[model samples]
Structures are given as C-alpha cells and as structure tokens.
Target: MKKPPIWFWQIALLVMIFIIWHIATSPDLIPPIFFDNEYRAAFFFGEPAKIFNAIWVWFMSGEIYPHLWVTLQETLLAFAIGTLLGLAVGLWLGLTPLASAILDPYIKAMNAMPRVILAPIFMVWFGLGIWSKVALGVTLVFFIVFFNVYQGVKEVSPVVLNNARMLGANASQLLRYVYLPSATSWVFSSLHTSVGMAFVGAVVGEYLGSAKGVGYLIHQAEGAFDINTVFAGILVLTVFALLLDFVVTFAENKLLKWRPQQAETETT
Candidate 1:
C-alpha cells in the first residue's frame, strides 16, 4: 500500500482531535464520567459544533469584518513601527561600541520589565484607542528584532570585513552591501515572532479597554457567560494569525532565495 502524504496525515490528525473534542463536549455523545450532569461538558469546554455555528453566523451576518479589520490595522501598524525602530537602533549600537555600552543597561532593564503591565498606562496615555494597542505591541516587537539584528551584525566574519576593507570598501559601502544583508536574515526571522506579538498586543489592548475588535467580542462573550461565542472569537483570531504567518513564510521564501537550500547542502 502507498503511504499517505504528509498533509493527509496532518488533516487526519486534525479530524481526530475534533472527533475527540466533539465526543467529549457533546451531551449524550459519551457517558459523563467526570461530571454527573450531561450538560456540564458543553457548559465548560463548549460544543465545537455550536462554536463553529457561531463563527459561521458571525461571518454570514458580516458582523466580524469591522472588528477584524481594526485588529489587523493595529497589528500591522505596531509591527511596522517596532521593526523599523529596532532595526535602526540595533544597527547604530552594533556598529558603534561606545553607544552600545552606554545604552546596554537601560535596554536590558526595559526588556526585562514585564511589558504587559504597561498596557493600562498606555490605555491611559492613548485613551483606550487603537494607538494604545499599537504602543503595547511595539514594546513586544521591538526587543525581539533589535536583539536579532544586533547579533546578526556582530556575527559577520572579521575575515569578510577585512577583505572588504582591503578592497577599498568605505564605511557606507560596507554597511550598505554587507551589514544590511546580514541583518536582513535576522530581521525576517524576528518578523515571524513579531507578527504574533503584534496580534497579542492588539487583542490584549482591546481586552483591557475597547468597544471594538475581536478581543472586545470575546470579552463581551465572557461577560455574558457565552462560552461558545468566546471560543468562536478565539478560533477566528487563531485562523487569522496562521494566515499572517503564511504571508510571512511566503515573503521569507521569496526574499531568502539567494540563501542556499538545506536539501542542497545535505546532498553535497
């Protein structure tokens, strides 16, 4: 018999998980071993079918698009601003030892501080708007990209630097041709993580204080004790996050094509 492809197994695994979840959560589907009451499972974990139906109804009614758009806007804005700032600061410090040394402790301290706590302050400062969400997200994203870019720049071989200098490469030329390309890889790597952080920041901000966005919807559901709607909101956010990750993967493949393939290296 022919072996199934990887995707087939992947989908099969997903189906199996759903089956188990459905069996566990659906009333009368299986005997209630833990809970004496049949409706207990649905009350706590929620029925998958009800969650799916809620999501379907949300989309069919065109009720989710505006909230989804707001979340995406906040996420994208935060990611862009944070990445640019991180890249600039990383490059400046990585290239200049004195500045790096001077700012190192402050940078470390800021990074060490639990940033989620700043959400309330940001909400106060930015007034429970998208900017507050974006601000929180920037804090989450900046350090990840900054450290990666710094390490990438520092990891450039001295031999390569010396050779470029010997070939009469000026500081500007070297930075443009060498350092930027080296850091580009690290930036892309950090971007995947940053995207998730951006979403988290946005959603958390909405959760803290907002009248709109999926987080607000989830919060509303929670307040009303609507477990299925809460699960539906989470499911929507998760699918969107995966879609954002897919976009990042596509961009990475296209941008990093100049890098050697792992399969080629292994074959060699």
Candidate 2:
C-alpha cells in the first residue's frame, strides 16, 4: 500500500495511545496483576471512555464555558501586560549599559526565584480572583519575554548600527527601524512558550484557590476522587492550549511574512 500522509500517521499514533490507555484502565479488559482488586486500575487511572463521557456531559450541560472563559481571560491579560512590560524594560536596559550593569544582579535574582511561590503571595495581595491568577502568570511570562527581547536588542549587528549612525539615523529612528523589529522578532519566537507559561500560571493559581476556572474544576474533581472528571478537565485544558498555540502560530506567520520561507532557503 501507498504510504499514508503525515497527519494520518500522527492521528493513528494518537488513536493507538488512547486504545492502549483504554485497555490498561478497563477492569474487564486488563487483569489485576498489579493490584489486588480488578477494579483498582479503573479506580486510580480512570477509564478513557468514562473520561470522554465526562467531557461530553460537561460541554452538553454548558457548565464548562464559564470556567474556560475565566482561565482564558486571566491568561490573555497576563500575556498582554507581561509582554508590554518586558518589552519596555528590556529595551530600556538593553540600550543602557550603565543601568543594565546596575540592575543585572537584581534581575537575575528575581528570575531565579520560584515563580510559583508568588502565587500565594499574589493571592494574598490581589485576593482570590482572576487578578491573582493574572499576576502569577505575569511573573512567569515577563522573564521569558524580557530575556529574549534583551538578547535580541543586544545582538543587533554592529555593522548595521555603524551604517545607521553613518546615515545620521537619530535615536528615535534607530529604535523604530532597527531595535523594535529585532526585539519583536525575538518576542514572537518566544510567544508559544510564553503562552504555555501563562496557561500554567492561571491554572496553578486557580488550583490553589478560585471559584471558577478549569483548574478549579480539576481541583474539585480531585477532592471528590473523581479521576474521570479530573482527566476530562485536563483534556479540555490541553485542547484549548493547543488552540491558543495555533492562534499564536497564525499570528507569527502573518507578522513575519517578510522573513524568507524555509522552502525557498532550502532550494537556494
């Protein structure tokens, strides 16, 4: 037979994984070799069929939308605010050697600190609302963007800088034409990772304490020993995270159209 397309293989792999998971967790299908009871596997790992059913029930009941919306809102706000702040600060420090030197240790210290530890502190400061989650996410996202932007600005070609200066390019003109483009390119490169971090921060904050969010749903499920529902919540979050990453990739393609295509480079 002719070889299948890449997507077909990819989907086949995913289906195979689910099939194995289903078999491993189904009490009737798998014997209780590891556990004393036949149902122990299903009780602990959960049945894939039941997990899918739980997810279907959640969506059909329209009970998951509010939680999803809350998580999305927190992630977006954190991403936006963190990116802006990081870009601004990175530009300022990247362009100023003296300030950069002075603040280097402090910046490193802050980045080194465990950001998850700040979630509780943020909860205390911002209360148990979306703002707290947003704050935690900002901490996670800010450093990633900041470091990328900083490196991008610092890595600007010295030849290009000299040429711009020779052409009498003013500070504002250099920043607009050179610095911003370079920094934004790096920002886009890190966008996917930053988005994932944002999601993690939001969910973790919700898991710790919140009235609404997919994380809150997972937490509640855990409390009730509802492994199926917990897995359902994780599945929903994973799907949405992939969707968000797709959106980021779309935006990157649109914004970076000026960059040479990989196929064209390869052909050359």
Candidate 3:
C-alpha cells in the first residue's frame, strides 16, 4: 500500500496524544506510577474524558457563544485598528528620514517597554471595557507591523527606485505602485503574529477584569480549582485561535497571488 497521507499521520498524532493523556490522568491506569491515590492524578492533570465532556456541555448548552463572541469582537477590533495605525505610521516614518530620526528614541522606548503593565492603566482609563483590551492589543500588534513595513519600505531596491524615477513616475505614483506593493508582503507576513497578539491581549484583559470572554471562563474555573473546566477553556481558546489563523492563511493565499512562487529543489 502507498504511504499514509499527511493528514492521516496528523490525526494519528492527535489520537495518540489523547490516548497518552487519558492514560496519564486515568484513575485506573498509570496513577500508581505518580501518586498513591488514583484520584490524585485526575485532580492534578485532569482526565481527557472529563475535559471533552466539559467542552461538549458548554456548546450543547449554548453558554459559550456569548463569551466567544465577546472575545472575537475584541480581537477583530484590535487587529484592524492596530494594523491601520501601524501601516500609516510605518509608511510615514519610512518615507521621512528627518521625522524618523526625531522619533527614533521615543518609538524604541515605547516598543521596549513591557506592554502588560499598561493593561491596568488602560483599565483605569477605559474602565474595564473592551477598549482597554483593544488598547493593550494595539500596543502589542503595532510594533510588529510597524517594524516589518518599515523594513520592507527601507529595503526597496535603489535600482528599482531609479527605474521608477527615470520613467517619470511622480511621488504619489511611486507610493501607490512601488512602495505599497513591496510593503504588502511584509504587512501580510506580520498579520498572523499580530492577530495572535491581539487575541492574547483580549484574553489577558478579560482575565484581569471582565464580566465575559473565554478568559473570564478560565479565570472562574481556576478560582473554583476546576481543572477539567480550565483545560476545556484552554482547548476552546486553542481551537478559536486556530480558526483565526486559518482565516489569515486563506487571506494570504488570495492576496499574495501576485508574489512569484519559489520552486522547491528536488532530492534523489
């Protein structure tokens, strides 16, 4: 028979993971290796069966929808706002050396600062609302896109610039046709990380202070020492992030079609 497909191995790995998790946390199985009481292992790591049940119950009851919605709202809002701001600033500074020189220290300082601590300050200003989370996420996302776009603009080939200029291309035309197309790839490259950062910011803000969102659910579970519920929340968030990443990948494929495909080398 032909070798199993890649997805077969992928699913096999997932099944193997669950199998190992089940054995490790099962009261009837390997608990003796780690603990005297069978229940102790289940208590600490949590049984995979219980974790899945918690997730199932959550969806079946429709209780997770509102929280998931709130989280998604925060994430999308932050991602859009941050990307626009980063793109504008990155292009502005990349084009103007004098302005870039003046703001270099300040920009570096802000990027170097620990952004998490600003969450409390944002909560103070935005009053424990989604804005605070959005602000926190913007701080995280802004730098990644800003740096990437800035580099992309700076790295535009001088020969390319001379050709464009020699062709009598105006400044605006250069920006539209040359700079943007070059930076487009860099912006797309940073998007996945920026989106993940935005999600993290939303969750962390909710974890710190919020009435809803999956992070709040995890917080409540932690408070109750409900290990299975906590793990379920984590698994849900992981799935949610993967879904967002899939969206990014789909968009990347559509938008980056203009980019030439790199050929793979053959092996003997």
Candidate 4:
C-alpha cells in the first residue's frame, strides 16, 4: 500500500513513543534492569507525573513566571539584535564579491572556533549583565545566517542577474528584487536553526554567570539536586524555542510566496 503522509506517520510515532514512555515510568511497571534499584531508576527514568506536578506548582503557583520572563526577555533581545546584524552583514557580504572574498578566511576561522568557551570572556567584558548574554547570542547567530545567505546569493543564476541588469535595475533595485529574494529562503532556513542557537547562547551565558534567566534557574536547581525543576526549566526553554521557530516559519511562508508551494510542502 502507498504510505500515508509524513505528518501522519510522525504524529503516530511520537504518540506511541510518549505512551511507551509513560508506561515505562509508571510505578506498576518494573523493568528487569530497575528491579534492584527502584530509587535510582526513578531518578534516571524520571517520574512524568511528578514532572507535570512540578510544572503545575512552578507555573500555577506563579513561582516561575518572573524568571521565565527574564529569560524570555534576554532570549528575544538577543534573537532580534542578532538577526538584524546577520541580515545586514550577510546582505553586504553576499552582494559584494570583493568584500566576501577578502573576509572569507577570517569569517571561517572565527566561526570554526569554540564560541561557547568564549562565554567567560563575554562575561568579563560585559560584566555578567544582559549585554554579555546578548553578545554571546549574537556570535552564535551571526555565522549560521551569514554563510547561508552568502551561499544563497552565490547560487543565484547568472542568467537571472543578467536579465535583471538588462531590465535597467540599479544596484539598489538589483539588491532588493534579485539578491534578497534569492537569499530569502536560505536565510529563513538558517534563521530556523539560528533561533535555537541564540537561545543556547543566552542560556549558556546565564549558566556561566547571571543573576536571572531560565538557565540560572536550572543552575540553581542543579546545585540543589532538583532534577525535576531543571527539567521543567528546560521544557520551558524548549517551548519558547519552538514558538520562535513557528514565528520564523510563518514569516517564511508569507515572504516566500513566490517560491513553489511543492517545495515548501516537501521541506515540511
């Protein structure tokens, strides 16, 4: 028989996995490996029920919102600033061949380095404030977007460029109508991944040294051996990351209407 849509299979598989997870962790179900060490198993396998309970207590009790808000603020600020900078730099480099060729090695070298390890340096320079987190996030987001946009522009057909020039398109017009549209899809693809990187950067910065944020909350929970709370904070961060990705998808849909619908469907 012909297979069902990918979404159908994906949803079914996810549901099945969740059900299995729930069953495996239930107190009544004892795996052979956990029979001798139930307490350790509980810790390792995790109590889904208690995870939900902890989430309720932290959320319903209004204990987590303030910290969540702080984390969200930092995440969003970093995402916005980083995305804008990436767009500006990417567009400039992509449109200017000479500039791109000149800076290519330097850009690759920087991007190749272990950026996360530089979190401490950012903290030292920006002094553990929101700025440090923003700076770190910017570093993470910039290279991903830059490379994609540059490649996208480079991939544009020479024929298309010639046609636009023949139509009397000025440099600004060419950039707006040709180069940007050419790179828009690639930019969005990079952005979808970059959103998570931005969050990672912000959170890692918080983990290293911060007075607030979800990462800070997770750090505190770890120090106290509150694994449940650590997991809860992670869940919250994941939800926000998904939300940001959805926003990017929505924008991509709107902006790339000219692209083939089948391409979008296949990508999804």
Candidate 3: residue 38 lDDT (0-100): 82
Ranking by lDDT: 2, 1, 3, 4
CA shift of 210, model 4, Å: 1.4
In candidate 1, where is summed lDDT lowest over 10 consecutive residues? 259-268
Q: Candidate 3, TM-score vs. the true structure?
A: 0.94
Which of candidates 2 and 4 reaches a greater TM-score?
A: 2
- Candidate maximizing lDDT: 2
Candidate 3 lDDT tens digits, 123-146: 999987788888888889889999
Please tell me which predicted candidate would have the highest TM-score against the true structure. 2
Candidate 4 local Cα displacement, residue 81, angstroms: 2.1
For model 2, residues 1-268, the per-residue Cα lDDT tens digits are 9988999999999999999989988888868878899889889998899999999989999999999999999999999999999999999999999999999999999999998998888999999999999999999999999999999999999899889988999999999888999899999999999999999999999999999999999999999999999999999999999999999999999999987776764433
Residue 120 lDDT in candidate 2:
85
**Number of backbone collisions per candidate:** 0, 0, 0, 0
Candidate 3: C-alpha lDDT: 0.92
**TM per prediction:** 0.95, 0.96, 0.94, 0.84
Name the runs in model 4 displaced over 4 angstroms.
Answer: 1-36, 263-268
When summed lDDT is taken over every stretch of 10 residues in candidate 4, the lowest stretch is 259-268
Q: What lDDT does candidate 1 reach at residue 210?
A: 94
